[model samples]
Target chain A: MSEQGYHVAILGATGAVGTRIIEQLENSNINVASLKPLASKHSAGKTVTFNGQTVEIEEATPESFEGIDIVLASAGGAVSKELLPEAVKRGAVCVDNTSAFRMDENVPLVVPEVNADQLKNHHGIIANPNCSTIQMMVALEPIRRKYGLKQIITSTYQAASGSGQAAIDELIEQVKTYVKGEEMSADIMPVKSDKKHFPLAFNLLPQIDVFEEDGYSHEEWKMIHETKKIMKNDMNDTELKVTATCVRVPVVIGHGESVYFEMDNQDVTADDIKELLSHSPGVIVEDNPAEQLYPQPLTAEGKRETFVGRIRPDKENPGAFNMWIVSDNLLKGAAWNTVQIAEELVKRRLIK
Target chain B: MSEQGYHVAILGATGAVGTRIIEQLENSNINVASLKPLASKHSAGKTVTFNGQTVEIEEATPESFEGIDIVLASAGGAVSKELLPEAVKRGAVCVDNTSAFRMDENVPLVVPEVNADQLKNHHGIIANPNCSTIQMMVALEPIRRKYGLKQIITSTYQAASGSGQAAIDELIEQVKTYVKGEEMSADIMPVKSDKKHFPLAFNLLPQIDVFEEDGYSHEEWKMIHETKKIMKNDMNDTELKVTATCVRVPVVIGHGESVYFEMDNQDVTADDIKELLSHSPGVIVEDNPAEQLYPQPLTAEGKRETFVGRIRPDKENPGAFNMWIVSDNLLKGAAWNTVQIAEELVKRRLIK
Candidate 1:
């Protein structure tokens, strides 16, 4: 690796998250000597603008990472599994946006704010946590630091972009069809790999990703396991309980989570938790109910900060409190988080 | 009330729920000799077709209930508070859908499937619980009865129709504006009484009603209080604890809820709970995650039965289980529940 400037390569450069990663790099403070855009063979001929320069994407293969200093991967789970190992073997530090390496014991799942120090433990690959888990960790890490966290029950209102660009296109197209009083069709949503597809236009689907054997969807399990791995580091610890219901709403960008959590300290008030989050990094508190101020998906679409509001102490459980958290699933949840992890690797000089 | 037939007056007949009540009556097995459509003076000239008959709407006043045997009220709370007692004084047994009499000690908050027995004790007014509460009551009453429920943690994804027709129109108009790349204006969502209005087209609003003391929104409080009243007539008994976070989504008709409940009996499996709900009245168990069969708002839009799915035993809490419930907010949540109450009064021969 060169100290003067770094040669960066973006895997899956033509996809939704990959394009956002390139945009994040353009707006970021990272010094770049050169840029390489790589995508699948079908998308290799496409041209994407990075830092106001037209860069042609090449077909992604093992040889593409020859001199790359850092790799930002968002192609999907299959691509990441195939190429991320070769990229790592080629001596490039990869920050993967897919779930391929997130649960790997050797790979550190990093949110930067909560576990930036985990970057020191990366074995050539640092896994970027899921969009939903990353935002929840950002909002909850501050409170969990002050008051010990015991349990979490979360329900997500995720946007179409989390699925891919095609899901967004389908949502917009379905809305157009609905307005025209035509029959709406769905070919990609909830879980594209699954048998049935449901239209998310003006509807709420309770499934995200495929269902697991025990009835929880894969998306829910990701939040459960990823949160545990990112927070505990000790995979066997069962002290912190987590359960999630991941749902897809009609929004296009941001994701909203209704989180109910119980703290070890029963005396912690909502104001106390609010004050802690207000001072935490990469977190914004928008909880003023009297003036009707709260975090909303539209207002938080392009923002990199996790917006939290509607803080209320649960009356039923003594140590429990409820809050509404919103963040751009593409930005803070995926792209920016990946970029932040890269920045941490640079700040700590963790890249080999 | 005569055994042959009954004269029914539908308050707020030109509104969303009011119109649905008329439709339900037309399709119901209950004998209706006469139908009186009543609304504000503005809607007096409007005509509504009931059972294929074009009926003219009249201004709702105390005199409108002179010959009315049952008054189905869905107007705003203020109108219900002012005119409902007047209608009751004219010997009409009123099933009010507004929150005007819900918290009144003498008024019975009845979800017919759960608390139709309490309808006999109503002093001229039977309170139809909030739309969110009605669906939750239908889904949970079965479980509570079979397993002995102890606690409830619910998060609602409510539809536009829950707020009335203007909110539904605003949601559609906002979607159209968003599609046209124009600035979307919202004058009726989240809370029209509040100073600020956020677009519900591609966003979610955390606050359904105005904020109450202790940081819970008014809509959340209604779910908390109304559930207690319908489930347990004795409010002093604090055995059942209910907490809620109500959110308004972009869906046009149905309301979806993610519910986590702890049962008094710890040995009940997820299948046991599902089987319990499958046999319960007015409940439809749609829980087959392996086949991608689950309850969704789009699928539950026009259905009268409350759909329950995604039943999973909680790994953290021994006695707890999580489930998803959805139903048409306009149908089962308001109009259907109100009409069912009237049918109960008819069956019991309590109206005079």
Candidate 2:
């Protein structure tokens, strides 16, 4: 490794995941020649502390990437779609944490532990998978590689933070009102711009995103399509089936999922899958039934690693298995994945 | 219906569901000659207000039903099993909320709207299906009657209250800690005796009950077996297959379910299903997508009727449909269903 440093820029620096990305990069081995923080105009004047130093947030614009060697974009899909190409055109390798470029034919959607090699085919810009997808891939890829994955059906217990800060605030306020036996009002989480908002403190909303014509939500569609792309690249099989029911829960930070999968190999047992996941990088196997050891959103919050438990074989399907997975939606789901991609870029010498 | 009501004894009346049964029965046509609220020795002497009058809670004993004409039991399976027989033997007709006698060959498992006729065969005691099963039956019975159901796949987004009052308290405490950026402590919900408790405020627990030998949870198995028992009595020629994945969510009250079903008739449409449900007693259709109207757990709380929404044809399979059904677990799932059975008992003159 060379001592030569690279100029880095963070897009959407004031957002929940953006702030975490900055925190994760602190004390890392990667050298930074210059640090650029960009955010929406509303948040531009604010200052965010990085490594104990106050970093002024600047307005995100195409010109902001002029001298940056690696750009981490978490601004959102709209901003990523508008400025990702501009950053790439300026010679900066962009790692976007938005859905904007994830399905783009030319952009490589990379989850470093699962499909880091996808970065080799990147056309200047790389895309980050959904937070929920990233963790599931991390846990399942090892099993998929050892055995053979056929079908995946996932039901997500996602947090409010997945929708951003306003959702978190809304959940807190709603719970306080509910506790006092008062009417709780909701204006965010479970689709803020939708026609109506429902209290999330003690409820579950099935619609995570506005419904598409086919009845599956946009979020559900993303999981289905993204898992196909990521698994196809990793497993080298284009026919792997994945279906997801993405739900917005009242949880503030961590996302939990009940995943049921059927493998092509019938001999794999729940213990065998647990063994495989325990050895997988960045995945912690917490599936001890006797001690009731398992992953939970509360414990997973603020942690970078994905926690898995409740592994068992499906009774109806001989080759099928069921498990529970939990992770900090803001950390491992968004920020840390983006940061990990940047670290991989430097390690692979993809960016200078 | 007579103004001179018979003597009524409420067994396990101090529970989450018991309180609601008292509320629903207040000022009803059924005469309450002497309102008796009974619970365990721990809850005895506590007073619960009914119809503007405070009723003293009594310790449940075999003699508790000596002169009572009807008994509503919401106690756990063990309590129901221990006491229900005594109540019935003492000339009181018992509507048991626990699963103690649900699949018992002698006990009639009754959902008033779907199987009120079955009340005639109750051998002194009637069983109420699990809460998740109750709501689904309300929403699907009509469709099944018309189109002939073949298979059902449901993923429940159940609330913490389904686990009991302590689970609800845990969720509240966890949310407070999450907002203050402090550690959360859990000791109940998702199986109290299980090794550890995790925050449910913003998370989902896939294992609702202890895992059975077959990998499916006891809760999941209950839904499957209960559906078979209930639907089996309705149509002789139809073969009904049911599979459920029950997940405990941060929701405090209502249980929401995502249900997919396939019918024998390919001509079935979402509008047709909605039309049948809107006219069906105990069911309210709230599927106006344009108005952003849907059944939410928050809105369904305290409501007696089951709320049905998100009704649409499944794009993947012809003649298949998907729907979102929400209901107050304490009401339709437990207490109200039991009360409805009492009403049916009185109507059928099963109880004198």
Candidate 3:
């Protein structure tokens, strides 16, 4: 695009995921000529580090993407809905980290390991799948590629960081109150505006995001719909079934999922599934039950790779198998995955 | 037995679940002539209160059950196997909370709400199902009875207390270490004897019990086998498929399960499942998404009833539906279930 490398602007640059995007760029091979960190008016003056240099955040506006080559948007859905379109109109490709455009007919919901080819077809905005769905797709992509996938049933142990910085602070405060034997109070969690707020310290909240009319939370529905869209076309097909229970736990960073999948080939054994995952890209198999090793949130924190473990066959069904999937919610689930898609677009020569 | 009532001896009286058993007995309608609180020699002199009377715990020995009419055993498996047969030999009916006798052909694993009739056929021991399985059986029994049951897939968020008082203490200590920015060290978690231990403070552990020859952990296997033995008469039938992924979370008291089940009757609606559980004996339905009402572990703590919520129909399978089940692990899972069986034995005149 210019004599210098690509000029990258990170929307929501002061937020949890946006900061991780900056850190990833420092280690990544992408040649970022200049970093434009954009945030809300409240965080406009804040400085964030990029490639060991402090970059002052600017108040995000429609015209902020004037000369940007790539826009990594992690601002909430409203900001993305209002500002991302202007970025695209200015000839910038946006890899959004929100649900704003995920289900749009023209946008492709991508997990690079699962559907990087979809990047070639992106109409200016390429949507990143939900964190829980992204890790599950990484673990199952190998198995699904080797043996066709039919249905998926998942239960997630998502971390507090997925809700953002305020929720993580709340968990820390609750833990301090619990340690001091004081009454624990909660102001934000399990849908901050919902009638009730539960502490994520030493507890599990089954509700993530808001509840839908059909009784499934928005997080659960996102997993169901996003997986179908990313892994298969024609999501309305009756043959492909995906269901999930998305829950919030006390973990601060990584998200863990207990995933059960039915394969079309009935004879795939647990060992066979493990072998496939070990060989798959962007997936690390940490399964060794004898030594009590598996993918844990603490172990996966700040890491870019998706970890798969606890591989086992469903004794009741020959076609079904179970595995544990974990990844840093701020990394692969959000920021890292967003950066990966941008890299893919550059690699394919699709981006200017 | 005696003029006052049946003589009840509680094994492992000083432990976490054992203490809750004493509390349940305090409010129970069963008339007690005497309360024999038995524990290891180390805790023999500890005093526990029952029905406003302070009872000293005696060292658990084979002779402790000489005149006991009923035995509520919450001691570890080794202690139960060593001393339970001695109690049975002395003519005391035992409701065991350990896994020692659950799989024995003679010992009927009973969840009173699901299979109280199995109590009559028990020779001496009526085994209590694992905490996770008991709550699931209570919620699903009514649905299973109205519409013939087929298959179940579940993932659990179990509390630290399920592992015992030591694990609870470990969780509390780990949380304190985390709050103070101290390096967290763990010695017992996700199975203490396993070579590696992971902190459960702000994280989740996928392995609950030691892994079997296959990749399934002992806890996962227990859920599968115990559910079949409790719900169906001929567990060998290939049609009854039960699979589970058991995980340990940071919660301290209640265990939560996300269950997906298929029924023979394809016409059962979400309302139909909710209506059945609401009227069921030991289940309390709390599914009102509009009001944000669901069964949370914090709300279910110290409660005797199993709370069911988040009832929704699976769109892919006409007969399949999903529900969230929660209960105090010590109460309904172990201590309360054991006490209920003892009460059932009294009500049926099956003891002595």
**What is the clash count for each candidate, in the order shown?**
0, 3, 0
Query: Model 1, which residues run further than 4 Å from truth?
Result: A233-236, B2-4, B233-236
Supply DockQ values for each candidate. 0.84, 0.45, 0.80
**lDDT: worst 10-residue window of model 3 chain A:** A231-240
Per-residue lDDT of model 1, residues A104-221, tens digit only: 9899999999989888988999999999999999999888888999899999999999999999999999999998889899999877888999999988899999999999999999
Give lDDT tens digits, candidate 2, residues B1-352: 2356778888878777888888777835566777899999999999999878888999999988888888888889898889888987888888888989988988888888998998888888999999999999998988889898887777788888898877877888887776777977778877987766666766677778787765567898898888888887422333676667788888888998878677999997777888899999899999876556778888898888999987876444568776889999988999888888887788778887
Question: TM-scores, in order shown?
Answer: 0.98, 0.92, 0.98
- After superposition, the stretches of candidate 2 with alpha carbons farther than 4 Å from their true spots are A1-3, A27-29, A145-147, A233-238, B1-3, B27-29, B148-150, B177-182, B193-195, B233-241, B262-269, B312-314, B317-321
Candidate 3's docking class is medium
In model 3, which regions exceed 4 Å deviation? B233-235
* Poorest stretch of ten by lDDT in candidate 2 chain B: B233-242
Model 2 Cα lDDT, one tens digit per residue, A1-352: 1255788899999888888889888745678766789998999889988767788999998899998888988988899989989988998999899999888889988888898998989888999999889989998889888898877767787888999887887888888887778988877757888877777777777778787766567888788788888887422443576667777877778888877776989998887888788889999999766555778787787788999887876554578777788999898899888888888888988985
Q: Which CAPRI level is candidate 2?
A: acceptable
Candidate 3: interface RMSD in Å?
Answer: 1.0
Candidate 3, DockQ score (0 to 1): 0.80
